[model samples]
Target: MDVTVAIDCMGGDHGAVVTVPATRGFLRSHPRAKAVLVGRPEALEQAKGEFGDEFGDRLNFQVAAEVVDMDESPVSAMKNKKDSSMRVAIELVKSGRADAAVSAGNTGALMAISRFVLKMLPDIDRPAIASALPTMKGRSYVLDLGANVDCSAAHLLQFGVMGAMLVAAIEHTDRPTVGLLNIGEEAIKGNEVVKQAGELLRASGLNFVGNVEGDDIYKGASDVVVCDGFVGNVALKTSEGLAQMLASFLREEFGRGLLSKCAALVALPVLKRFKRRVDHRIYNGAVLLGLRGVVVKSHGSADAFAFEQAIYRAAEAASNQLIERIGERMAAMDGVQQA
Candidate 1:
């Protein structure tokens, strides 16, 4: 596997402190993997200082000269900050200097810069950010996670196909089930767009599971859930918030009394595992699907471990040649012929 990852050293909240160590950790585990750290030379030097020779050989540095601010408008950043870290890292992938690009920066800006720098896959109309959600059974993927807010039925159907391909490749789920996120599971429930998308998916010759209600997400009824960015983003955020609230509530209950503390002690290991399973940080990376190259987005607040997972995810995506697979699938589908 050509596991080379380009990381924006200036992308996250903690900047180089997080990126540098995470790169070191990733290289430590993957001796053959290469990491190109992109950002201001001075900051990257200081951050890269922590690793010394361990990452010195496998690591290369690119001076981005600028950064795309988290609050800046996505289009403005793309138009104005041509030399930003986000743009530079994406350029590496486009130029074949790196196999994948990983960033823990502004989601909107990253998407914008990636679209501008690396371009989209041939048959893709718009790129979607696909994230894996760990379910009771295992892991499932949700697509258009805040990438394209308003989507047509065709867009949602395409998302399902791409998402199914992704999970099948990475998660080893052959014939991964696809479902359209809707208000209800019934065939005639949602508005016209969803109804049309559902019909398209069911007839697309893929493993379509019909419609899936929001509440059924964690139940793992489907392996790939497709929706417009607006609905998918709301569901993602709601799940994260609810998980936090429940963990806090459980801890509070454990602190209530001596008997409660004793019970909590007995269940502490199980609770810890549950907390780890539900933490958003544990599932820190999202793939910018439909891009010409692999681009993984890490949460802005991610720490070293989260960054490590992002690196691993990027490596897996690149090794799998996700974009190439998508192109092949599109070529085979007469309706969505490769662009």
Candidate 2:
């Protein structure tokens, strides 16, 4: 198989109920991809019974004796749940048994276990959570999404490099444009850290666009947007909340009166298209970048389709040699510095 993702079958809200069905759906779509179910064997029994012979060799299982809880502490989990599905899945990636690992478990725990197990890629100081968000033109990748709450100028530069490489691997682009998230379009608008980050990005050999305002994200100002985890996390949560509010407003408007109900019927198709465009479920996967191995974090409450998207994301990263590409870029930077 070109790519094999270890699935944390006992992670997330629905555990095997969602992950198993999602894996089956992902396998059907990606014929070249294989998946290893990692969880308590009994937890995966029903899944094995349902799709055992359907994919046969394309699918396998790695029994994990324990399961990590949704509210578990990273330290507690690591010390107590070594055999947890989440840890075992990451272990598969570290051991080369799997090219990537997909999980919809506790974000902090997943990040901790992954970093502890896989370690950081050479010269990458910290890992970041990167995800694609819908824009007016298309979608743009954003990084440091709640991973490193506090970051230095160098960390932001590293985020830009990793974010660019992620876009390169997934979008097949050689040099994706990168932008700094700031309060204003002007370089002097943000704080000292952002100002220093702007300077570093300018000389980093990547396609560095100047500062972009909050509204510029949806405007598709750049192919990738770079920021520290604090700002990135707030932006992400705000966008989700905004989408929900808008949807609620639309429902309330449509139900206001008979006249509005008639208008809603007339605009039903348009509304459906709009809903599809903004559906958070379609963009459920947030990749943990800068790790030695590929790891994707699915939203904890994701359904089968949303979780399947996460699996597909993991497969794409592995097949496209994402880790190798990022490593090459970092190596090139180091070589330039040495010269």
Candidate 3:
């Protein structure tokens, strides 16, 4: 197998019911990929019986006694739940048994256990969450999504580099453009940290775009967008909420009357096309950047199809050598700074 991923099977609301089927789908779609289903044996027994003969050695299992709760505290999960599915999955990455790890569990616990197990990449003081978000042009990868609430100019610069390298390694784009999330396109628009980060990005040798307003993210103003976690998290949540609200409005309007029902039937194809374009499930996995290993977080409430998308993302990053690429980019930037 070109890529081996460790998946936390006893994670998310549906647990094995969703993750196991998703693993089956992933293995079917990715012939060159292998997956280790990590969870309690009882939860994975049926999966083992079904896929064991089908996949042979391509699919394996590692027993994890405990499961991290969706609301569990990061500290408690880190210190207490040593054998939790989330922790065991990450451990596989650290031991080189898996190229990457994926989990649809507590985001906080996953981040804590991941940092504790895999550690941060060299010269990377902190880890930032990065993910691909759909845009008008195509998609743009944004970083620092709810990882660090407060960030310095240096931290923002690091985020830009990591985000760019992620796009480069996974998307095969060299020198992907980076944009600082700001209030305006002008240089003097945002806070000092953002202003300094823009200057750093401009001089850091990456294809740095000047500044991008919030709406510019959907405009695909740049290939990668960098912002502090506070802003990034707020922006992400707001977008999600807005999408849900618009969808609800559409449903309500369509069901209002008989004439509306007829209109909805006539417009059904166009609505489906729009829904497919904006479906969050298509972009289900979030990359935890700056870690020494590849780790992806799937939405905890994801269904089988959505979870499979996360597996595909993990396999893609592993096969593409995302961690090594990020390290190389960081080292290159350090050399420039020193010279």
Candidate 4:
């Protein structure tokens, strides 16, 4: 297998500056893989300049007249920006022209285009963006990062099943544990949605591990944490901000004086490694679960390396039969009727 990936060449902060080089680097490492770079023809040409003969021969591009802006609303933008690169790239996957699609664009627009073009898997009410977060214990899957803001208890149960399947398949875990995002670990805690969803998940025959609090996200209390998009997105952004703040605080503390500076020099490598582990960009991107095809969302400000990581994550999603597995799991759940 040669997996074909479609990159939204014009849809990120860095545009093709990051996408083109990332494609080049991915192809260099994954010789069997191919890419369809979707964007305005001239912008892609300029970005393609860096790869010279190597990429000129290996790559392909599909022209899309427009690029989705970062600030656009999901539903309205997808309806209006039909010629957008994100829309075209997702269309490629839906049409079987590409095995997967990757983008660092407007999260809302990407999710909308994905739902419109690729549709959801059988029995899935809404697709979700699931990310692998590095934990002190290791890593865990957190779903509905920004996909469905208003979710039902049934939806959270679906997330648990699908997310568990994702971690088990892609991460090579056997019977990955599942948890509900809540204010406390007690079964009686959380809002009505969490409490009701907890009941469903506990009875759903999956490996449900009760509830986990916000602090447990990186403590590895569970392999999969299920929540609605609104909460998950807040948690994700808060984690990112905290990670950056902590890194900056450490740097400032160490650079205060000569003795501290000397200690900082000695600790630089370890600190840098730790920072990389916490930065979500290092983990970079994740697959949008419950869709008919693999769709990955990279960091909006992703660089070439980050884009490359996103591509790799997309490939893993495809190879693991993520869509198929999620469908099977959701179908097995008692409440979700197969459509």
Candidate 5:
């Protein structure tokens, strides 16, 4: 199926410098996909020049009047920057011109504008940021990364429902297991809210696998992990920091002396494999689940390669009909409730 993605060319730290090249690279691999580049006409023209006719008609452009600054508050940006690249790109999806939208912009601004433009899915109170994380058993999806800092037990239950449906659509899993992030494995261990969320998950007809701790995330105890935005953001940032620190330490140790350098040369192949396994760029896209339309958020500081991964992820989700699948799952749940 042909998938169309709206690109916010002026959203990230590097703006068109990164997004344009990333879109080109993504199109090279995904021939069935098309991109609508949204940004200033001058910048988009420059990007078009760089690609020449290689992209053919697969790549197009739209002019956006303004740009949203990284430090701007979400509410202020939403109110003041109506024609901003980020908002314009998302608007393409709302207008049925794009199957999905990808932006490496301010997370808050993206979320706020997206919610304002696309609204929420039926039976979905709020949307959550859901992303994949590397795990020993491959990878797992985690939700509420930073969208809703204060989520209710009911909200968490909705996240589990949306996340499981997402995994089922993208990974083709019949019944992906969902785990509630908690202090302990026992059902009664967490705070009242978490305990209540657990109770709901256990009875919600989902593949509830009980509560899992921090260690269980990388251990791959479940296919989906659920938590409020605050905890999820902390966990995500901490993992990123640890990965960077480990890489720095390894570099320092490898250059310690001639002997260490020689050992590093001998182990270069193994080290490369290890780096690929843990590379965050391979998982650059975070889906804003429960939105009426498809929206993807790329890491703001991502480079061309990393941003390309985000585009690839957006195309996959669109082609797989992720939004429709989530609706069907929720509809089934409603049927059970009405029974």
Candidate 6:
């Protein structure tokens, strides 16, 4: 399958420095893939030389007249930066020029521009950000990671539906289990919105697994975890920080003495495996679910390898027809609700 990805080259902290190399790396792995690199002409030209002639045909550029600042308000960016790289990249998807769009830009600005350009999917009132996190059994998908801060019960249910479909489509699971994030596993615990959401999930034909706490995320309690953006973002950042802290502690301990260094040498292979398992770079892409088109958000501070992972994720979603699968699931659920 040929997947064409529109890359916002000037959207991230490193901008072309990171995105250009990542695009080249992504194309190397996905031979049938093409990239539309969106940024200033001079930057693209420089990248073209760096990438050499082998990727000349597969790699293309779209000139973006402006760039949205990282600290700019989403509303202001949407209103003023019409020709920004983020907006232009999303426009490629809206215009059917690309299968998916990838950006490591301002999260709010990306969401705003995506909604304005591609709009929401039918039957979806709002979009949620969904991303995969490593777990004991495997990886679990979580949603609303800083997208919609305040969501209704109905919106949480929608997130559940969208997240379930996403896991099903990408992971090839027939009926992925869905769990509502709460303080306790009991049905009665949590705020009114979560309780209502759990009730809705139970009745909504999803594989509702009752409630899961924060630890359940790493325990692989469910394939999909649903929560409001505020809570989800907190959990996401906390886990990231914890992972970094663990790695730092390990490094410090290993460098403490000659005996520790010897132990590290003997355990190098095991540590490498553990590092690969916990590395956030491998799972850098966050899917903006409920949108009409595929838009992946990479970590703003992502390096070349991390951004490449995001590009790969965007291409994978496009190839799997993630948007179509979500639409079908929502339609079926709507039909059942009406019945």
lDDT of 3: 0.91
Candidate 3: stretches off by over 4 Å: 185-188, 335-339
lDDT of each: 0.85, 0.91, 0.91, 0.85, 0.91, 0.91
The TM-scores, one per candidate, come to: 0.94, 0.96, 0.97, 0.92, 0.96, 0.95
Expressed as tens digits, the lDDT of each residue in 1-339 for candidate 5 is 499999999988899889988998899998888999999889988988998999788888999999999989999999899999999999999999999999999999999999999999998898999999989997899999988899888899899998998888777788999999999745558899998898888888999999999999999999999999999999999999998999999999999999999999999999999998888998999999999888999999999999999988888888889999888888878854333
Q: Once superposed on the true structure, which residue ranges of model 5 sit more than 4 Å away at CA? A: 185-188, 335-339
| CA lDDT, candidate 6, residue 204 | 91
In TM-score terms, candidate 6 sits at 0.95
On TM-score, the candidate that comes out on top is 3
- Local distance difference test, candidate 1: 0.85
* Candidate 5 similarity to native, TM-score: 0.96
Please provide, for model 4 over 224-300, each residue's C-alpha lDDT reduced to its tens digit, 9 standing for 90 to 100: 99999999999998988887788789889999999999999999899888767666666887778888999999989
Error of 1 at 225 (Å): 0.6
- For model 1, give the RMSD to the true fold: 2.2
Candidate 6 residue-wise lDDT, 24-104, digit = tens: 889998888999999877887887788888776788889988899999999999999899989999999999999999999
lDDT (tens digit, per residue) of candidate 1 on 1-339: 558899999887877888888888888888888999999979877865766777666889899889888788898888888899988999999999999999998998998888888887776789998998988788789988998888988788789878988887677778899988988645558999998887778777789989888877889989999999999999999988887788789889999999999999999899888777676766889999988899999998899989888888989888887778787776666574221
TM-score of 4: 0.92
The sequence of per-residue lDDT tens digits that candidate 3 reaches over residues 124-152 is: 98999998999999899999999999999
Alpha-carbon runs more than 4 Å astray in model 6: 185-188, 335-339
Candidate 4 residue pairs that clash: none
lDDT of 6: 0.91
Clashes (N, CA, C under 3 Å) per candidate: 0, 0, 0, 0, 0, 0
RMSD of 6: 1.8
At residue 28, give the lDDT of candidate 4.
92
Error of 3 at 232 (Å): 0.3
